[model samples]
Target: MAVTRRQMLAGSGAAIVLSGAVDRLFAGTAEAAQAGGRSGYGPLVPDPAGVLDLPRGFRYTILSREGEPLRSGEGPVPSHFDGMAAFRSDGGRVRLVRNHENRVTAKYRVPAIERVTYDPQGLGGCTALEVTSGGRVLSERVAIAGTAVNCAGGPTPWGAWLTCEETEDRAGTNGYTRDHGFIFEVDPRGRRTDPEPLTAMGRFQHEAIAVDPRTGTVYETEDAFDKPFGLFYRFLPKRPRGGFGTLQAGGRLEALRVPGVPDLSAIQEPGTVFEHVEWVKVPDPLAAQTPVRLQDFGKGGITHAQKLEGCYWGGDRVYFVSSFARSRDGSAADHFGQVWSYEPSRRRLTLHVVFGPDTDVQAPGDSPDNICLAPQGGLMLCEDGDGAQHVFGVTRRGTVYPMARNRQNIGTDQAPAWGEFAGVTFSPDGRTMFVNVYEPGTTFAITGPW
Candidate 1:
């Protein structure tokens, strides 16, 4: 396949021009619908099957679901689908490396394949799928297995997925054979998957990561709740651009430290910039005794944010999310969500967007997580909040609209059940947009007139 603009952007760490995505994020409900009260492909029409609701001229294909047998003959597809990425394959097919956020007690654990299991007693991992540009599933298999809480992660410029563990389960706990919260690399092609945890990267409740393709400097996020809230981190690898196993070579893991700021949520305004940011070395990346967040950072303490999630590389900066924050949850401030961008060159961190605390929970664009730059233009954010679930879109004009909704009522007439939309991404060919519903695990390939 020919190299596309997205590929080039990934290779060079080109900056993503958000085109006012930040401004639109917290836009008032009145201004949000300024563009005919809809943008992109227009308002979403309800899905007839009661699955995924999409805009007119758009449709979705359920590629796989929980409890289904894999086309590759591996065991059933694992439950709790989360983060995902698409890679160009040899033929016209696209490769997907999807994560399953199964806990230690999950009923449907990811099955081992090609002898690539991380820990026998662990219950979470990732699966690989090969599909056509039109959303046909050609094959499915386990890419990595026996890890735990494989939540959201980011894609690599070298064409791979960095699956993160959102737990810090220690050895001997709940039948765990080894320490559980480190990042692992998975090659969707089923070649070069390193079963060993990238130990140099600190062990913690890792939510996501973004690799600067140019320098291989990894920006990581810890999603722990306040018992010492999570900190933003980076792993400076020894061998920068080396493909799969390069992370095993070792690197330095450090947490972000914004001079006078200890809690990031205190900043309520967008465009709040902190300059000359520093990184403190993690005392114990393995966290043998004390968790990384609990470790001492001395006089200049590290910066912390609640629910740090969804990481991606745009242009020369690394963008990440704080799913949501509440003062009642011990946060310094409260807000619906926040998106931050860090510039290595400037050694600066800026609050790019801040969702309103009053955003209608049942409406579009609340608690955005697992974000991605939509191939067509603008940004796509998965809704992980109360009320109805939707995949919200921000058009170039800074108008926010509901691009898709989860109409799957897994509950009942009185208590309708639904899952948060996650892992929103597009194929290299940009023909389909793939996303996951967390509960009852499902993957959907949404195609529409972009």
Candidate 2:
């Protein structure tokens, strides 16, 4: 049975009836419905701080700024802060493990230590920041170093951040001495440990990851914008809940497939659901020469999407973002982005939201990157498109509304230097939310009524 917009607006009960035993993860809220039905968190107001503009009644605190010396005295905080995750610490403080999306040519690099460094020449990794419950920064230090393009990753149920590299740059290339494109674990509590790449997770252009807490299965997304695109993958660990090194020891990597659907481009349409999906094992998890998506394509059992990014686990499904997919590599019929929800229990994937192509920043077609389940019971998305970027709130009824915007300017010229919002996540207690501005690299702690 196919789910429709009308059915979604009818309520969660109707959704349950229509989809059988499948859970209605995105059921609409009364507050969302009251705000003109399907409209977002209301209009965004200008910021007095000259950094971010938020909705009325909401305020932001700049926790960490880029180009400053680290609190731990390693070096200046690395720039290009990308994906991040928040965790509760011992003394009413929150710990954040942030990714630095730097490459070999980056001017700054996170200082590398012998034990935790993967490749000294690799200029990307993660940093740990400790902040009080009141949003005051306590300390900052390099958590994992000597990696390439540490883009986005997720927190494990066992309490650690899985930092992913969004690069396929191999060893001996671009001044790199070791292989790139792997995920590394970092302890959020600033514990000392060796950094090891989980080779069994399948090396590719890893964009983001979401682990199913119930199964300990890690679902990964790849960001490949060029031909052959990327595949949605899952790593089944050898042991369900082993210590830190379980993923590194070994695992089976598989790609998602929708039984009879040869190509998944049909998912570009809103509310399209692919039922009864299956997994195709990768011939070589570590594709040293060939990419993993290509390996899945050669086997003829897997389907791929263009530029898969930003995924999170919520309710009983894994919600993932596909940033701008087209019929062909350069086709005009391109979707700015599409949000898909995958139900592991039922082995199904549903296209929850699809954005049409529109150049207007305020339009509904804005490309979405990072995503998280809102404490108010919906989804919060980080816009990564042309012109001004925004953080959009999608209600259970599928209405999109702007929640925050970047109003940072360039020098005295007053030219807008729009920065894409990344690493949107709420604190464990849900009292605060943490997000990052891609350029100039700033982390903000936002608090307000939901």
Candidate 3:
């Protein structure tokens, strides 16, 4: 909640020089914090750009890009595309459900995911695609109809797409409906216009979702705009072991609060940085309509993370990354980079990885957005920034490597880059990879060696 002078300048889109200052701030700081051992390995390449770069033989190709036409006759998809998931329908065909984070000027073109084409009438876009092993689009359709600004989402075990809207407007402005902040369930194989919004998921500025199949609990994160002090949430379905199909049955949504940092209102002030943060749980998430004040959930002395972005569930824990927790305020807390792992079994969360704010592993804006576990167990991250945006990989030993860049140049893509490299996931067999790009509005099939 605290904002600094530099943040003020950046917020106002003013010009300033903090690169040198930021560089000095990171130098020698890694070893100082290490004490005895290394934190993790740095990025694999000095700088990987435009094309996909893997270990010797791995390669990638664009399956679909924003604005591309669908086989079902839909005109094209829109911008602000975020997260996605990969699935198999026919013999070797893969299906993908992708999100779009559109705003005022942005609007959905037509239905394409479920293969039905219809005029979007200014609505934002979310699509599903059927592609081949070689990255060829066989069919594409809109999964959820009549929704806009669709952000990051998670795939349900029952084969449904949980599409989330990132706006809070009860009645959306810019011609979008008021249903902007809700979650919707779309049949990945149905017609684009067939489903209804799944209001069970608490409406807010939802950023991403991760599902715990063991408990049937849906973990979600909200993106707060001004000096982000958002909350993480968990939705328990009404049915004891329900999921996907039961979303409409309704359930309970709980907000994540850091244990200490007693006062969030204090961080609301300008030029101040939140410190001594811990995690606390808030009973209700929808209570505060405007800039919801989330409880701190961390205990002991831990750096507070502001904007909670990309998340993935693997092994016994759920991993999440914080983009831009540092750099804004001079406070050396959750800056640099961080990866937090939550162990549902023991109900404990631990810090997994921390990178220097200005280090090569971390993106310049701290916008290391979407994440996915690689076949070998490391993590693959999409850097969310302009020109410099590229896909980076993190090994189990914590080695970072730039895999590819968005040279296709979709207009208005999110940095660390949004849209194209935005959402990435491997198939069950780990032989095929699917990526969703927002701007040029496309989804691609990436296949090669491992």
Clashing pairs in 1: 14-315, 15-315, 16-315
Candidate 3 has what TM-score?
A: 0.74
Higher-TM-score candidate among 2 and 3? 2
All candidates in order of lDDT, best leading: 1, 2, 3
**Given candidate 3, what's the lDDT at residue 47?**
17
Candidate 3 structure quality by residue, lDDT tens digits, 1-450: 344332232223222222211111111112222211122222222215544433334456666655666556656655666788887688877777777676666654435333322223336556677877766777766666556566777777677777776766655356544445767776677633345555656767777787787787888877654444556677877873754567778777765444554212223221232223233344344433443443332343222346667766775556666665543443325354555656566666555444443333333234667877665444567766434445655443343444544455444454333333588787756677666555666555555444
Question: What overall lDDT, based on C-alpha atoms, would model 3 receive against the true structure?
Answer: 0.55
Q: Of 1 and 3, which scores higher on lDDT? A: 1
Model 1 C-alpha lDDT per residue in residues 1-450, reported as the tens digit of each score = 343332233223222223223643332122323332235556567566878877778888999999999887888888999999989997779899999999866878998654899888888999999998777898899899989999988888888799999999887988888889999999989888989989998899999998887899999999976648999999999998868798899999999999988888898777788888999999999998899998998998788899999888877788889988889988888877888888899998888777765433222346788888765556788988765677877655555666777888778888776798889998887668899999878999988666
lDDT of 2 by residue, 87-199 (tens): 98978899999999998767678888666788999899998999998888999889989999999999998888999999988888898999989988888875634587889
TM-score of each: 0.91, 0.88, 0.74
lDDT, candidates in the order shown: 0.81, 0.76, 0.55
The list of candidate 2 runs beyond 4 A from truth reads 1-41, 296-299, 327-333, 358-365, 410-415
- For model 2 the local lDDT of residue 421 reads 87
Point out where model 1 deviates above 4 Å. 1-38, 358-364
How far does residue 422 in candidate 3 sit from its true spot (Å)? Answer: 0.3
lDDT at 449 for candidate 3? 44
